[model samples]
Structures are given as C-alpha cells and as structure tokens.
Target: MKPALESSPGNPLAHLPFYYLDNFHRVLDWIGDRYADLLDGEEQAFLAGFPALPQPSRALFVRMVMRKGQLFRASKLQYDEIGCPRAAAAPLADAGWVVADPAVTLDELFDLLQKPEICRAFALPAGLKAARKDAQLEALRAAHDGARPFSGWFDGDAAYRIVAKPLCDRLRLIFFGNYHQDWTEFVLSDLGVYRFEKVEFADAARGFRTRRDIDEYLQLHACRERFGNGEHPADVLHDVPPPGTDNEWLKSRRDKLLFQLGQQFEKLRDWAGAHAVYRECGYPGARARAIRVLEKDERYGPAWELLQHALREPESEAERQHLLRMAPRLARHLGHPRTAAGRLAPPRRLDLALPQPDGDWWVEGVVRDHLCRDDAPVFYVENALINSLFGLLCWDAVFAAIPGAFFHPFHHGPADLHSADFHRRRADRFAACLAQLDDGSYVDTIRHNLVAKYGISSPFVYWNALDEDLLELALHCIPPAHLKHAFLRILQDVKANRAGFPDLIQFWPAERRYAMIEVKGPGDRLQDNQLRWIDYCARHDMPVTVCYLQWTQQ
Candidate 1:
C-alpha cells in the first residue's frame, strides 16, 4: 500500500512505510471525540468529512493535525503552513519511498504517535528536530542516572517513548515522591496519554512500592513502639516527632506547618491542639493569647492550665498584672467567687475619724440599736430620737460631728441658718456618718422623722430645712441617684400597672408619700415653680420634699 499522504505533495511522513499507519488512526479518533464539544460547526463538518490517512503518515498526521487544530481553535484562526509535508508526500511516493493504510483504530494511532523513532520520521522544523534530539539525550542521561537493577528495562524503554520513566524516577527521588501524589499518579496511570505499557505498569508498581516503603520507614524509625496497639494511626503520626530538631530546614518547615495547623485548630475551636502548637513554638505571648481565645470560648480547664504554665515561665511585670486582672474574672466565671475575692488584695484603710452622735455616744451606737433592737420605740429612741432631739437642741454640735453626712438639712441643723461653711462641714460629716451606717435604717430614720414631725403639712418646709448637701452626699455614697431613679421608675410602673412593686422598693425611704422634695442647699429659697409644684402636689395629695446641702459642707 502507498503512504496515506502520497496523494498530497508536502506530506512530512511520505518517506515512512505502510505498517506504521496501524497505530495512527486511534489518535485521530481520540482527538475527534475529545474535542467534539470545542469544535465549531464549520470545523466539525470539515473533520467529519475528512477520512483517516494511511501508514506511518497517519499516526504523524494525528499528532500534527491535533496540535494545529488546538492552536487554531485557541487562537480562533488558521495557522501558517510553514512545512507542508502532505504536499511533498506525492513526490516521495513517486520515488517509491511512501506507503499508506486504509483502516486503523484511535488507540493504535495513539501508540504509534508516541514512538520516538516514528515521530522523528516527520518533516519537523530545525528547532523541533534539535529539541527532539535534546529530549532523547536527556532521557538517556536520566535512564543512566536512575539505572537500578529493577528499573533497568522500564527506564530504558521509557527513554524511547514520548515521556521517559527514568526522568520520572529522578523527579520522584528529588521531590521524595511526597508532593503532588495525585498529579504523579495521573501522569503515570491510565489517565495519561503517554501510555507505554511497560512504563505504565512499572510506574503503578513503583507508586505502590513507594507508599509501602514510606509506611515501613515511618513504623521502623518513628517511636511507634511507644504508642500502644490501641493508639490511632493519625495520633501516632502527630505525636511521633519531637517539637524541635537539629535540622534547621526541617525545624523551620515544622514551625511554619505548626503555625498553620494552630490557626486551623483555633478555627475549629480545638483549644488543646492550638495551645500545644503555640507551646511548641516557645512563644509565651502567643500561647497566652491562645489561652485567652480559649478562655473566651469557656474552655476553662485547658485555658487555666495553659495560663498557669505560661505564668511559670519567665514573664514581664505587665504580664503578671494582666494575669492578676484576668485571674479574678476567670475565677468568678468558673463559679469560684471566693477564689476571685481572694485574688483581690485588701483595700487600704482610711484615716478619717468615725462620727460621734451626741453625749459621747457615737452614731454607730444608735445605728446598732436600730438594727439589733426589736422595740420600735427603743429603736426610734436610740437611733432617731436622740439624734432628732440633739439636732433640735444644739444643731451645731450634731452638725460638727458629721460634716456633709446628712441627706437633708432637716436631718441636721436648722435650714433658716445661712452659714455655708457650717452647712458644708455638716454635710461632709453627715456623708461620713451615713457611709458608716451602710444600711437602710439611716434612710428610714430620716423619712420617719420627717413624716412624724412635719407630717407632710408643708413639703417645702420639710425639704427646705433638710441638709440638701448631706442628703445628696449620703444618697451618692449609698446606691447613687441614677440607680435609685431606675429602681423608683420600675416600682412606680409596677404599682401603676398593678404588677406589684418589689419588697425592696418599699424598704427604700425615698419612695415615701411627699408632695414635693426640692434638691437645694440651706438658705436657698424655693423657686416659684418649686412652690407651684409644692402647691400643686398639696392639692393633689402629693407631698413634696427638698434635698440639698450648703457648699460649705464640702
């Protein structure tokens, strides 16, 4: 039979024999099927109309046609006809050097296309010829370099194929065959187009052998004996290596890997693993930071242990302070309130003298009686009665004892009194006294005294005569007005809505029925609206009280 391209003049494979065409048809069919989707209507029609070529030219034609088709399809145009071998084939055939085949399979064509000697028969460009020779030389070099007893036939045969097995072996050695396992498998397996039977089988076996060798090496060299038979393979793999090694490259690689692993662990909320990696890096700050992250997630035990370990390491005073602050909060969160309290050092003691009520009996004596005694009359007599009487008798003496200590002027000296310094001092003393009281009795006594004595008759008089400074100071020192307002608003809403006010609100003296309470100092007369509000409240059965203290009290 004549070569397939003998009818065409410039055919590159015009010199090859007919027997080589057996394998070329397989590659043509594969190209047609593989690129069917990408081909345009015109190209598909043209390809469909074209018949398979004959002989060695057929195999060569498949490769050249596929490559040109791919380039044309990619560039969306026809390519230059640099060396038109098909056109030259007729002349070569005339010289009785060419042959052709009538029928062939796509697989057979693929095999023939892969044979290096057959490929060289094509009328290739000078650059391509040089490249092909260089590739062959390199393949030979690789085969010689990687020549092992078992790999001899495989490597030598691959050197003659399109892809060299020896070069693949060298690559495996250089990269340890650890990187891109899937990619290497793809290139060496049935999935690859360069499928020389011997090379394919050899690569498959090599892959299996390499995997087994790796497993065996790990089992033999790694501390596998330390891991009981019950341990998981993954756990053994992870714990096998020591944190750091003398190999600087390995150590650096490990550090990077560990850091990346720690980040992933943190994302997974694997606090234990994250902390372990951080600890391995020997970065106390990072470890502490990881512990903090774990703590936020309520991984208490692990975070606590990590923190303890970090604390034991050499750390700055700032770090200690941070730990000190965090310990109490964490302890409280962990349901150890007492431990939290223990972490707080004792508060420094103040040097100010305690307020004495009257007749050498300190205010504490009256406050204590009020709290301890059940007798209402006795309680009033000791806590409220003595102070009320003493306040009315020698107001200065009582005011002097507790400066800025009363809630209102009514609780201290007279209000018509205009001495700012006296009121200021009395306000201060009253504040100090209330500070000592530290209970609800003081508020109750003041409210009860006002109601019992003044009877809400003139809310302005009760509020005006009250030590506003002392009242304000006392209130501030106690629960504070904003908190008091919140509590009162809630109580009022509850009462108004019939929700039932809390018992605590009833205990608050500020909630008592007063027409109007003016918050001002002594000698500070009521404003017109204040008087109007007082009048309005009186008419509406809402009593008013004024709460303020003189500036001198400060």
Candidate 2:
C-alpha cells in the first residue's frame, strides 16, 4: 500500500521497503547520539550490540516491540518482506534480545489459542465445548492455572518473548519525552497524518537533566501501571517514589499519581487513607479532595481547618469554588458567625420552550438555532472560540524552545504545560504576548499566527471549530480588555480555566456588540466552573446570559 504523504519527494520513507525498521533505527541513533549520558550500562550494551545484529533480526525484533504484546507466535509472524519469521527470529533469540520460551499465565495461554486449539489441547467436555472463551478458561483454570512456558502447555511452534521490551520502552520514553507515543510517530509524520512544528535545540537541551530523573520516571510509571491494574491504593502508595526530586516535571507526575490514588481511596470509602494520600499530594485538586474526604467522614473540625488552608490560597478556581461551597455549613458546625460573601446578581435569564429538534441534535444546538437571527448570529462555541483565539495569540510563547519543553519533534505542546511553574518558566514570553492586547498590536499578531502556525497541534487550538469569518468577527467584537481578562484568567489555571466559557456567543456586527449565552436544558443546573465564569463575567461587566430550555413537546 502507498503511504499517504504531505510531500512525497521530501520523504525518505517513499523508497524504503522497510520503513518501520528505518524509523526504529532513527530513534536508536538519536538516543545514542543525544542521550548517551542518560544511558545506563544495560542500555549502552543494547545499543552497542544492536548494530552487530543481522538485518533480519533487527527488523523482526523491532516489529515485535512495536506490536501490542510482548509475545508473538512465530507461525503468525510471517512477513512477505522479511522472508522466514523463524529464521529472522533465531538471531534475535541467540542475541538474548528475545526469549524462545518465556513463561505465560493460564490467561495468556487462552489468549494465544483459538477455541479449536484449546479444545484439541485440553479435551474439554462436550457440555463445556460450546461455552464462551472466558468460560472455557474458567473450566480449565483449576487444573492449569499457574504460569508456564508455551512448550510446557501446547507443544506448538515457538513464541518469541521480547526480553528487551522494558529497556526499549525507556529508550522510547527518552526519545519521545514520555511513554505515550511510540515508533508510529515517525510513520505518521511520513504518512502526512500530522505535521509538527519543528523547534531547534542542541543535544544538551534534553528532557531529563540527571540519570535519577529517568529512573524515577520509570519507577513512577510502574507504580501507576500497578495501581491501574487493581492494586490497592495503600499498596500502590507504598511503591510510589517519594516526591523530593528537583525535577519539577517528574515531581508533577508523582503528585498527580498520588492525587489519583487518593481518589481511588475515596471511591473505596477508606476516608483516612484518602486523607493521608491527599495530605502529601501538592497536585492541583488534592487539598480540596482532602477537605471533602474529611467532611465525608464527619470529621468537621479538621475539614474546616483544611478548608481554611485551601481558601487562603486555592490552587485553582475549581478548588476555590469547592471551598466556598463547604464554608458556610462548616462555619455553622464550628459555632462561628456565618459570613456570606455578597453574591452578584445572576446573569439575565432566557426561558424558551422549543419542539424536539431533528436527528441527534443536542440541547445547546436547539437553543443556538432558536436564538440565532440574520443580524445577530450565535455560534455554539462552548470553550472553543476563546481558547482558539488565545492559542493563536500566544503561539510563540506556548511553543517556545525552552529546555525540557520541546526536546522531541512530535510534541503537541510543552511537556510541562500542567506543571506548577509552567507560567513562571515562560513568564516573559507570555507577558509579551498578552501585552500586545494592551497596545492594540494583538489583532495583527493573532492574524499573523492564524496563518503562519495553522494546522500545527496545540493544547488549546480547536482547528476544525475555527474559520476566517469566526476569527474576524471575534477580533472585532471582543473588547481588548475582555480578551486580556480571559487570557489572564487562563494563565491562572491553564488546566482548569480553559473550560467553562458560556456556551454560545452571538455577534452583532452592525452594532459592534456581542453577548455570551450559556444554555441549560430542562432540570440541568450550572456546573461550578460555569458558575465561576459567570461570576467573573459579572465582576468584569462582560455581557453574559443564561438560557434555560424546556421541551414544548416531550
């Protein structure tokens, strides 16, 4: 099959018969050259030994590693391009990169065999022969539960165990800046599925600063994986690496994992354990979770204390909203005089009753259609328009070539976009971008970026949702002050505040005025983040309204 290409002549993969092998080699070369210092003894040995392996062995090993599982049946691995699968794998087995007979659990055995194969090998009773694969597994499990090599069970052809998977996974992590992406990134780029913004940097500008960082990242990843696989929260917490690392990026990951463990503890209704996990976690929403957990257990005084601490400096607007909701009742519990912050008058309300709309139309769409007019048109922007505008204006700042941010070519955005010090690291750059709004330079800057940086991946840009008319309308309609306010608020909590904008924005081009409307269907209530945005709009005197919808015919 011909791989799709953005520009065929420019791609080296165009002529390559073994494109995946080439991509894998490129990653190995990049890591060996750029991250030589980070490579430990085993990794270095693997890199040194890889070059001496036969070409077929290298290609076969990479194919197995890129696939879903660690085990590959030799018979099933037939490749027209690679000649004989068994012949190709023999050198890899000899090189100690793959195990010819690795242990497999009963479940793994079941997964490896078809029903007929299982029936032939195990001789299932006729009554159980027609059952589901899992039921067959259960029936056979009592006699054949323990892990054993494939040869011990089936007496079938060989299965290759990728013994080098963990080592290669770490190398992949270093090359891609995380474990999420794999070798297909190069192919995707080659196939024109994505076009990344290339940022220039020396080899010294890699993501990991010290060897400890790499080890800690792998350790934490293992812990996360173990927890995800139904390990107890307390047990997972015990395995999680302690959080004193100087690498803020790794530290952020550690904190998020702890926060997630705390949440799992909450779900398990182990309140004390949840509180314990949350106490050490400095992640964005940890303190709020701790407060809520305390409240759930009716430990009112401690909950009140923690709530006060969170209220003093809430990490996010979402956390602040949660704290405010807890305060009055908690204050009453403590016999303290209830002090209620004055609530602003709510946004103007629109009540509408409309017919059930045509195929698969949502409530927001229904309201948008009903309210839109020839002169004043409404777009169901939700969070897209403002975020797209912000992303365009701050394109340079967001994609800045800071060390540890853009180590790899395929980054959708900075690796540390959610880290606590993300803004502080790029303070000057973001300041410059936001300052353009003040001097009226933003219009031209945003317009320029919209064209220049078009189609590149961004955390904030919704490319499909934006068009020229929408951009021009927003540039003219949204006041510079309003845009600045929204940008600054986003800077406050990029992770949380990007959402919760009013649902629809109506533009009145002739009048040069606009209003943001948040639509709510029957029985629906405003979410906390939405309420926070509404409160913000009220304080800033930005026109916003809440439209409540009811079905005229149900």
lDDT of 1: 0.35
TM-score of every candidate relative to the true structure: 0.21, 0.91
Model 2: CA > 4 A from native: 1-15, 101-109, 118-156, 202-204, 297-299, 341-345
- lDDT of all predictions: 0.35, 0.86
Clashing pairs in 2: none
Which candidate tops lDDT?
Answer: 2
Superposition TM-score, candidate 2 onto the true structure: 0.91
For TM-score, the strongest prediction is 2
lDDT of 1 by residue, 94-193 (tens): 3322322212222222233444542443444555455655454443453244323212222222111111222222222222322322222222222222
In candidate 1, residue 299 scores what lDDT? 80
Q: Across residues 185-239, which tens digit of lDDT does each residue of candidate 2 receive?
A: 8777776677788888665568887888898998899999999899998998898
The superposed Cα distance between candidate 2 and the true structure at residue 406, in angstroms, equals 2.2
